[model samples]
Target: MRFALLGVAVLAVSLFVMSGQMGVPSDLPFPVQVAIAGAAGVAAWHARRSWWPLAALGAVTYAWLVVWPPLLVASYFAGRTLGRGRGLAAYLGACLAVQGVSALVGEARDGPQEIMTASLGNALFMALGTIGLPLAVGLWTRARKETAEERARRLEREQIMRAEQVRAQERARIAREMHDIVAHRVSLIVLHAGALEVRTTDEETAETAALIGGIGREALSNLRDVLGVLRTPRPDSPAPDLSPHPALDDPDLSPRPALGDPDATYRPQPTLGDLDRLLDQSRALGITVTRHDEGDPRPVEETVERTAYRVIQEALTNVHKHAGDAHTDVLLRFADGELEVEIRNQRPHGHPENLLGTDLSGAGWGLVGLRERVELLGGTLRTSTEESGGFLVSARIPA
Candidate 1:
């Protein structure tokens, strides 16, 4: 508003001086003309922000004839920029005030008779030309600028939202990969260490194996704690239980356990042959899972078997989380050079409600981790909602 006022004042003063040089309104002193222009600028500036200021300015402009048309023009634009209702109000108020002031001044200077003789139509013509058109143009420009700015701001917000989503997805992917790879290996180490401690007969060897087992258990505990921090679980997810282990939690034990003899060896890990055992365990837990082996069962590379097993394991895990009692079907198809595994679950019925129910819906990166694992083994996995309102997960890997 200040800038607009300043610009108008400068322009008006320049024009007035130029007109004075041409002997027009030359009777007014130079200083008086500058003051009139300044007042006009100030009034115009106020007009843009509020109707009251613009109205007051309009009255003052009417009393001061030297700043007539510019004041009127400024008020019109101010009104248009303000919007139709307010702008029109300002424009009309200024116009009427100008005419009223003009009439009173004319009566005082030229007498009531001469003032009444002047054509009222001519005043109306000047007001329409000077104020009406300028106000309309200003309003149009203001509306256009506002619309463009709104669209740009909306797009900027959407772009920022998309970037945030991508960052969240990447964070989840990293967390899942760490859990799948590191947790599996660490679990194996813990298992082997425990077996060695139980089997060793010599006191020294047994003590060393016991130490290794203690370290592995502590490591596993620490790993779970880290996962708790990384994976922000949903409301329904069970809180991780990090209860102290009786053997590993001895107060006399060193704060950090020393590395013992790393002689514990893991047994050949379960491959696809052990899937029947997995299904049996699920069945024991009251989950109905039917398995089908298509084509002649044949041996495959260790990596392929391991990946296939993990895929089914993850699928089963997800089912247990969402709907533990749901019936599921597992299919293992062996082709010439490829092995395909499919696990589908009927929509969840319901689980027995309890405070300590088997709800292990931890970090929701199970599927994401499984996909990455499968892809790493040159396999493709697809999961989708079934038309029958169930769920389907399928994976194919080069055998």
Candidate 2:
């Protein structure tokens, strides 16, 4: 709407200037004058795209018919568009040449005496009005536009910096809480598990206690890694030492291998290849699980495998919590360009309430975290109750 109004204003002003010029004596016919006025309006309207063409036409008309308005508009656009070098110099030179030509034509008609007096004064007035004033205003407009864009860019950069600062502070706070609370508790669980393993006389009980202690120590080590990342100054920095802290060491506990050690027990990220071990752990807890594979097995990206493993891990954990002793079916379908993981458990033999009680019924954040993990890999996770009173958790991930 603003541009339409501007076009209308330009046309009106062009016609007004042309009409006023018609009163002055000229050899050009009336229709020719009207056509030139129409052309001037069109040139002014399109001056933003290429002002040089308008400048050329305006220079000719200004010299021949004393049409100054179109030339003035063209000069303004030229100032806004042209650089302050060869382009601007050439335009000023052309304007000077046109002024000289106009003066010569006037002298030829009105004689040297009038040219020296009135022509010189009129030439100065025309130069100031047609070139100087409009050109200055156009340059000012260009400067203002550039300033506004710079300010917007600066504000955007500041906003990003502020957001990063807030995220860093939040990460630090979480790390502190986990270190003070979770780390301490897991350490104690590891110590107790170690003591249990030593005191047990039965071979199976000692083995189970050892497994618990190993799992607990691995958990503590992983928590240390998490805290290390949160407390790091930058993401690209070297990882902190993965060895257990001296404070967490216990004489009853066997030494776990440090990261980078040849016999390290901890794997930073688990993949689908680790699914067997996970299944064995569940089976050891007395859950009947059957595994099925569909389609030809193929190598998948490590990240995809990790997310897939997590989906199944979280699902089986849910099974243990809510559907104890349930027969669970684990399916891995490798399709053309995607991998599908489905874990479905049949109805438990006993009431879910009587299974493990509420002690194992976690805070329900595991499924939420699993969903986020799957979606981050451009995948989908779904959980629903089966018609057979079973629970189904499914995930589809891009390979």
Candidate 3:
């Protein structure tokens, strides 16, 4: 579009120069004037795309004749687009070349006295309107454009900085919440599960209880890893090349392997297949757990599986923390492109108590984290206390 405008301007200015000359110009022949005008049009096209071409074309055309409007326009654009020193040199050189050629041509046509007077008058007019004015305007336009671009870039940089600051603050907030609240609840669950291991004499129960305790400890470790990522200062070096959002088919969702431990292995994440193990762990703790699955139980997305497991983990942990000895029922329903998990427990027989001596006063951040995890996967989580007397936790997630 801009080049088209330049083409139109070049044509219009060239025709105007030709018409304005009429019969008054005689230093150059009519054929040479027409040829120079054609060259000026070509120069205009090249000038818009680059300064070097304009500089070269301006030097050629302006040195030959005085009635070339395209050369003046091209010189102005070269000045605007090129570096300050280079642009100024090109503009001045073209102007000087024009005056030098006019003087030589005029001297050859008439006597030096007659030619000098006419050339001086022509040079003065050209200097003010053609050469000096265009250079000044181009320089002014260049300065204005550069100033506007700088301002726009500064605003963009500021916006990106502000966004990064906000993200850092949010990460810090999540870290604090996990430390103050989530860590406490998980610790209690681990402590209680460990207590069950010692208290139970039944071999099967002890082994199952030990497994649950080990799982809880592992969870605590992973939780700490996540916390480290949130709290640690950003690395000075570039982050590892990894996808921001891994494909659903991707087995690993972590952006990169944990730093400083090539020997350290990533633990397998829990999914629906691990649901039985989770229920068995709770059962070993002397809680009555009933699980039922409806619809053909098939494989689902990792995120959906992970979130569903987390929902159950949180629900069962709450059962241990706040509703000891309660009869808990877990329901899994797989429907068209969705999976739903519902956990409901009957009223506790008495005061809340865990296998551990801890008072079981939950720190309350588990549900907060659970909700965040679920919503992040484009799922909805709902929890409520039944009027009949118990708590219910539910999650509906994409499959």
List lDDT for all candidates, in order: 0.64, 0.76, 0.70
Q: Write the per-residue lDDT of candidate 1 for residues 1-399, one digit (tens) a residue.
A: 565855586447535642544112424666766666666566555555554554455455444442344545565566445656765676577566666666666555553322331348745654565566666677788788889999999999999989978876775676567567765666667667768878888877777666656656655555554554445334235434322443333332313323461211122455787788778766655689999889999889988898888888888877766766788999999988899999998867753332112345563577789889889988899988775657788999988
Q: Give residue 215's error in model 2 in angstroms.
A: 1.6
Misplaced by over 4 Å in model 1 are 1-31, 38-58, 69-73, 76-95, 103-121, 204-211, 225-399
Per-residue alpha-carbon lDDT of model 3 for 17-48, expressed as tens digits? 54444212434566765666666666666665
Which order, best to worst by lDDT? Answer: 2, 3, 1
Model 2 over residues 1-399: C-alpha lDDT tens digits? 543454456556655655654223445676876687777767766765676767888788777666777788888887788888898898889899988887766666674323432376867878888888888888889889989999999999999999989998998889878867787787788788778888989989888877778777767766765776777656556654433545444433334446576424333677888899999988887799999999999999999999999889888888877788899999999998999999999888866432322455364689889999999999999987776778888999998
Query: Per model, how many backbone clashes are there?
Result: 1, 0, 0
Q: What lDDT is reached at residue 278 by model 2?
A: 90
Q: Root-mean-square deviation of each candidate, in angstroms?
A: 17.4, 4.3, 9.4
**Regions of model 3 farther than 4 Å from truth:** 1-72, 83-129, 136-144, 147-216, 233-260, 263-269, 293-300, 321-329, 344-372, 382-394
| lDDT leader | 2
Q: How many times do residue backbones clash in model 3?
A: 0
Best prediction by TM-score? 2
